[model samples]
Target: MQAWQGIDEFVSVVEQGSFTKAGQQLQVSTAHVSRSINALEKRLAVKLLHRSTRQVSTTATGQIYYQQCRQLLDGLLDANRTVNQLNTTPSGLIKITAPIYYGERIIAPLFNRLLQQYPDIELDLQLSNHNVELISEGFDLAIRLGSLADSSLMARRIGSRHFDVVASKSYFARCGQPHTIDELNQHNCLRGISDHWHFDVDGRRKDLRIHGSWRCNSGLAVARAAMDGIGIAQLPHYYTDNAVEDGRLMRVLEQHRPHSEGIWAVYPQNRHLSTKLRVVIDFLAAELGEQR
Candidate 1:
């Protein structure tokens, strides 16, 4: 009897909570998956699972058994993945998560280049501003801006960002440009809640709040406001670099620029780093470094 095969089937069924999903994932028929689990129970001489029409739950004995078996199975799978990665090259789906605008503007192009280098890798990008748990979400890695609050994660600093005080040429022509940071109080500003511009002149990092007619949560919207000559917006270099280079917006307070905030690639603290994740992180750090 293939004990490991039966164990694998049992673990899959319990994890998927349904015979059908487990079968599909394992590429076996539902009847076959059921049979495998039944066979496992008979061999173990104990009931391993409680099954209902909607879902499958592990019994106390099953739960303990599952935990022990899961570790063994995962170790075996990790060894296989490691060996395969060493024998071959990096391939398969690599799921990455990053901020929406940052990913589209910065990371996407890098990924395009990476794909050219490794044609075998299938890149899956999920863009969102909300923080996602890398392990729980099944993401290979996550890109984060500023300092991370979670100590459980292992973070590698990739790059840094400087704030740009910007306004459209049209707006500047009407409201006049602020020669000093203090003058920004009198001008219209487009504010994004998530983006709080802070500055450290001689080692004091403090918030530089500016009043605005329009307040938004989206960074792109704030950029659009500045593009349309709505108001002066203090945005990150990532958002304003293209606009500044294109002459659509003018940067102010060049001398009083804030200290650069850090960019990080974060992952769960693990004893072993997967090859796919390690390669991707190194690739992105190089890519973002080029932008600096």
Candidate 2:
């Protein structure tokens, strides 16, 4: 094989830590990966990798080589992508994560349409409420809600996540409505996983601790409980919009409703942005930004 060919295999082995995994990444056999790396080392007359049974680490020389080669390889990928983007349609596998409710309600449908448009494209969708580390976990993108704190990751606001405090008409008729944030002290506020309710009070954000006879983790479940006149619940607009419009629920304390939270598409900053990542992020911004 050409000397230049093993650069990718060697880098993959270094990144993946095992010849087997490197081969899997490069779509080759472990024996082939081992032989190519050995050949590359033989040609260079240098020991690049310190290999052992459990894992592999780079030699001192190898570490420096890796840093330089990684940049070159990443640049080559970008150059290839630039050329291929003009010559071919966008197509690749994208691994993504999003909150379960929003993923099911919004993101899933948009991706369904995107898939129909580009049948060659593939997606591995992971939906959960927890924060995911994109780089360590090998995810291509993440759809995050609320404020962003991880400066190491890059983000783009795709849309807004508006929230409201709402209750069933019967519940309010029996208990009474709260006109201000302080009035919630006497009301049954069905809490989600978070005990603190957020609001914009006098141009500043406030976190008011709320309680009820009932509490759950799901916003959707809390919204349902409030619909049964159990108590008032704070929920994202996506959950309460249809109910409020149809009179199943009535919004209260609109003046105290916090500014709509940001819906963001986030990815690791250090990694090269591939064409697949570009298409997904651009698609999200265009498709969801219209909702703002």
Candidate 3:
């Protein structure tokens, strides 16, 4: 407590750049601020500030001390906030957005569980494939998958998604299994939202352009086409995992399967995350990670 004597006054003076302004901010007189800092300098045996009638500035030693003191003060403030928040029950509506299929298959159910657990907390979840403007649209958060485009939004990885190139057993039996990446050109490759399929080739990622008579933007439709032996399809593990296990579909080019991509919870960088939002994000991260 003794060592903490003049820290507040010194930090405030450095930040405000004037003893008078620092006194105003701390609700003390300018003479009091000046006396406290002088006593601190004598105790430390160091010159902390260069002062004049018109201006005040930190000494080299004072700059270093200010940085460290600022961090300590910030930590103290955060700790106080945490204690206060713990006593406050979270009760508010949180607006969120997520991809359509993932929202239906994954996020929605978890949110249902969350609602059941925290009766006071409400949710408005919007399911869409389009990347909506979170700030402009007034959304609290967004769940994004795969490689994220560069943006200012803050992101936390909740889980991962793996892609599988798969087709029905009957289709493999008729067309024969393709052993290598180049052989994909000869086989009828089903197209989805993207014309290119990702793979890890010789320890590096390679996007192979694929063509086939069958093309659909919907992953479900493309999966159905593959099951019907229309063509081979590339889809996320969630879409094809059950079918592959049940012998409805068989994975191909297993060795070349691309590395998993992160599933992220994205939110505006400047948004103040409330207790409800933090609880929801933590729940989603835990559940989604376990499912993966």
Q: Pick the candidate with the highest lDDT.
A: 3
lDDT of 2 at 229: 98
Pick the TM-score winner. 3
Consecutive 10-residue window with the lowest summed lDDT within model 2: 270-279
TM-score of each: 0.68, 0.70, 0.88
* Regions of model 1 farther than 4 Å from truth: 1-88, 194-196
lDDT of 1 by residue, 1-292 (tens): 4777698889998899999999999999999999989989998899999999877999999999999999998898888877776666777898889999998988888899988988888999999999987888898788899878957888998888888889999999999999877788899978898435665566676676778779888888899899999998988888888899999999987877878888999888885776667778889888777766
Residue 213 lDDT in model 1?
76
Candidates sorted by TM-score, descending order?
3, 2, 1
Worst 10 residues of 1 by lDDT: 194-203
The residue-by-residue lDDT of candidate 2 on 81-159, one tens digit each, is: 6777656676878899999999999999999998888787899999999998888999978999998885788898988
Prediction RMSDs, each to the true structure: 10.0, 9.1, 2.5
lDDT values for all models: 0.86, 0.89, 0.92
